[model samples]
Target: MSAVLLDHHRLQYLHEAVRLGSVRAAAEALDINASVVSRQIALLEKELGLSLIERLSRGIRATEAGALLVERFRKWEADQADTVAKLRELQGLKRGHVDIVLGEGFVSDLMSGPLGRFWLRHPDLTMAFDLAGTNEVVNAVAEDRYHIGLVFNPSADPRIRVATASRQPLCAILPPGHALAGLNRPLRLHELVDHPLGLMHPSYGTRQILAMAEAAERIALAPKLTTSSINVLRHFVKSGLGLTLLPAFSIAADLADGSLAAIPIDNRLLSSSEACVITRRGRELPHAAGQLLRFLSGQMRAFRAGEPAAKMKPRATRR
Candidate 1:
């Protein structure tokens, strides 16, 4: 073939056929007849003067020429999507959407206050928030799955760039009328070793930090109860099951309402955690998402500074 014009529909059929490993499957996915899909792929192969796929017993595999074309075309599709999203963003804040992913630890009064405030300002803008583990949040942001992410005690990840971070102290959460609630000073590590401990699962960053603190002090903390849910831990502590340790932001409302008392940790290793707002390193966020990112970062800083004094009502099934 000397030269060829790009036929978008035919190229789409070929891309789908390669992706699904069968023309019939691609046709089914695209809600079209199988013969049309097959014919389109044949035309694309003839124009390109290349055998684009190798038929297998069950399905198929893309040949070398097909693989390279598909890869470049996917990149083109991504760039085109980015360009369209940018265009939509220019219509003003009232019409666009922002997708956010965050860890369960951040479903707090601190978050709700800012979220509520922002939505009230841009009532028509759509927002989707998803909960994942800290590491998952980072990975999702790096993979461009979300416009922004919030993670507690986030570690260094080269694929992501931190937009803002606030140091959150890990505090001992004591139930109302618990013995330790009366203490004025920060709690020492050894002081907590004997308490009936309710803690988050070992996979949690907070729990990992607590473990390190225990190891440094030559003490092993056998938690009486362990759960993956921060809300569960909060409720357990509130019921006087046992003391639990978490970031101050996670339980700020409980502390304010006198349901739980927060005593700062004295150990340097366990003193504080970091809550960071992160985005993909090189990709520029859409205008609305970028606005929300800055808003969330400010809210984190405000919470760290102890600005919002009133008890904030929790909303929805958070985290």
Candidate 2:
């Protein structure tokens, strides 16, 4: 008997259908008709001689066999990309793509210097960045959807490997004239309670660290506003609506321009928070991604050692 062969196109259709939860959704994503997606998956199921999907009223789900196949296909796609990258390396081509997912907080530091300098060094290479919360960043990296993850105080995950980490404590951010801005020393968590507070949503790593500190110190924080956008939190404080806690690197430019002030928090857990560069465990990155990772490890302010608050002295109050 001849060896069995599975069509790559059929497998891709099945993978997208299961991933997107509907043939129509997959068709939209793949820019094809829903019937094409259905037909391709049907052919895949027939060729494999197994039930691949369970069609439901709401959407579709992969069967056990389908799930296994999808997993294998994902790994195979990652490997194929890696192989192409290696081939480019062998050809001494200084060109490839790197995909990175990171917390919104790191955007400033990344774009400030590292991104520009790296692009100058490798003009042919392309890069993409997706902004996500810490959990999303970790999951995207671990699932091989992204090549690198930049996060703060990431939870320990066996599937992730930290390339480098630097001490980046959480700091209370205040508008230039806020009462807390006058404090030359670390601010106590309790000091923030009476003031209006804006906070990142709980999905943010900064919020996670703050939650632990709140629990440890037995303090309850009630923020008037909760949002997922770092910009919103920054703007909330800058507009003097309220203060928020964040890593100094997140708003380095604001701190430097004296539009905002960052005061250290006098909590151990908050102080212990770190900025980390993470990648999937046991996976060799493409050459371009690996190079970009190393560049970020050395150049990004988040991964650099030093207290950002030291340079962020509160702007002297005017009478």
RMSD of each: 7.3, 4.3
* Tens digits of lDDT, candidate 2, 1-319: 2355978888899889998899999999999999999998998777778899999999999999999998778778888999999998999988899999999999999898889999999999988889999998998888789989999899999989999999887888888787776668678889999999999888889989899989988989999999999899999998878899888899999988888888877777887889999998978998899999999999888988674543565322211
Compute the lDDT of residue 229 as modeled in candidate 2: 90
lDDT of 1 by residue, 200-294 (tens): 77667788788888888899888999887889888888787788887767776776777877777777776556677888787776677878888
Using all chains and alpha carbons, the TM-scores for the candidates as numbered come to 0.72, 0.88
- What's the CA error at residue 135 for candidate 1, in Å? 1.4
In candidate 2, list every pair of residues with a backbone clash. none
Candidate closest to the true structure, highest lDDT: 2
